[model samples]
Target: MATNYNDYFKKNNDNDNNSNNTGGGFTPPELPNFLNKPIVWIIAILIVLAIFAKPFVVINQGEVGILSTTGKFDPEPLNAGMHFYIPIFQKVYVVDTKIHIINYKRIAEAGSMNDTRGGIKLYPSINVLDSRGLPVTIELTFGYRLNPKTAAQTIATYGFNWEDKIINPLVRDVVRNIVGRFPAEDLPIKRNQIATLINSKMQEKLDKLQSNPVILESVQLRQIILPNKIKDQILSVQVAKQQAQRVQYEVLKAKQEAQKRAALAQGMAEAKKIQAQGTAQAITIQANAQAKANKLISESLTPKLLQLKQIEVQGKFNEALKVNKNAQIFLTPGGVVPNLWINAKDKQKASVSK
Candidate 1:
């Protein structure tokens, strides 16, 4: 039976092979390649070239660039505009060339007006003596700017925190030194002069620093403080002095008025005396004129005028006798009338004598 089965299988295989040969033959389609190694390498090289090329950076107006080579400072600086630099090795720092302002105030430890903390706090108390050795408190403000060209040099010489190292110390020193020279009273009255002095001192100190990174523009005294008790005392004294001055002025005015009145009285007395003298002199002159006229008339009288005067007297006597009941008459031979007498008894008598 095994032999019969093997012969049957072999006969079936030969029959199938004969059938395929008699039928038409079939073929399979080919697939294309997606990626090649040379193409991939070319794309990578392009990407690397783009990154290595140095790119330009634009610096804006009113700005200066600080160039550094390999993390170190470059001797030359770049001005405002587009500038080229090594992408990996060179670095650029931009600094503003224009002026800048900063404001600082002194604060207390507990932040109160009078409280003070230890070790020179942000807003610290300053003690100074005046000409009178009185203690005073002072507050001040100042304006400053960074020097553009010397910024790097300043930082290099005085460390990166140059504002704290150079600026703060110099301002503190100048303020204290200037304030120390004056008294509490002068601080308010001479504030402008004090500011000028501080500014001059600050400039001198800045010049000595040699860094030239910071410039002191101006200094101002903002506030002046004094002990309350002392202030009150000074005010009271000033008031008393002013009152005394007012009294003195009133007295001076009164004295001037008195002097004017005295001068007027003296003038009136002098005028009256002159008028009396003038009146007396006029009376004397009139009396002298009348006496002269009387003397002239007496000197012109003569003997003929005397005889005429005698005859006129005799004629007046004769007229009188005719009306008189009692009359007496006497005549001389030189043309004089003889004596004649008429009595109340009706007796009449006449005498003729030589």
Candidate 2:
């Protein structure tokens, strides 16, 4: 270790003078002779090693090192793992390349409300005037990451204030501007569209800030706070729409039922018409059969059949003639049958003759 007096340059000058005065093969100054002891040399060598190793850095996974000389960031950057630089004349700034999550909402997870690990709640809600001139509060969370390819550009452009100066301000401006274009009722309906718009807008601004881009992975719109009256009105409108749909469905169902009954009635009427036609056809067939039988009988009649019929009538007349003297049975000259006859003039003459 250099003492306060030695650190001031006086001791360094004296050492250089003594080395010039030695006039021998380039022997180190008196300090070396004093440092000749094993322990002293060991300590000196260790100190020298430490100084050389001071600028050596092991950049872990997902980390990049930016070289800075005399407080000026170098254009070239170092990748992960072991690297070396000039000590006291140069320094390295380590930046994480992994994604960073920043939440600006107070809404918690399902169980925990105050978990600090969730995220830092900066300004929770963004107050904006919507399209309808109504005030709406939007709660949101956004994700970003330091671009690894152009580590030097990132460090040079924003250093460690990328989130505050570039990302945060741009987010506020884009989100507020976007939300203002939508009405209070439309905000919730267009939440996804709003988030995508904010992400794209913010990305455009952040990309312009540095050659290495800070990518916005996503933006989540948590909640839209609106007045209770507006919510109730929206609910009523939804209910009315539902009721109208139900009525339409019932009307359609009744129409279908009426169609079904009409089809049944049509089928029954057709069946009855068919039955009536069938009955008329049956009666016609029976009449045709009876006419055929009567024609056969009339064609088959003969003289012998007529004589048999006359004999039957004569027998019946004789049976009646036995009961009364004035009655007598007889046949015509051609053998035609005289069945029965009553004459008032013949009855008077017959009684006078008797």
Q: lDDT: which candidate is best?
A: 2
Q: Which residue pairs in model 2 clash with each other?
A: none
Candidate 2 per-residue lDDT over residues 152-246, each given as its tens digit:
77667776766666666777788789998988887777888888888777777776774845766778888888778778887898899999999
**Listing every candidate in turn, what is its Cα RMSD in Å to the true structure after a full C-alpha superposition?**
17.8, 12.4
Q: Global lDDT for candidate 2?
A: 0.73
Q: Indicate which candidate wins on TM-score.
A: 2
What residue runs in model 1 are displaced by over 4 Å at the alpha carbon? 1-63, 75-82, 102-135, 263-354
Alpha carbon RMSD to native, model 1? 17.8
lDDT of 1 at 18: 76
TM, every model: 0.54, 0.62
Q: Candidate 1, overall lDDT?
A: 0.66
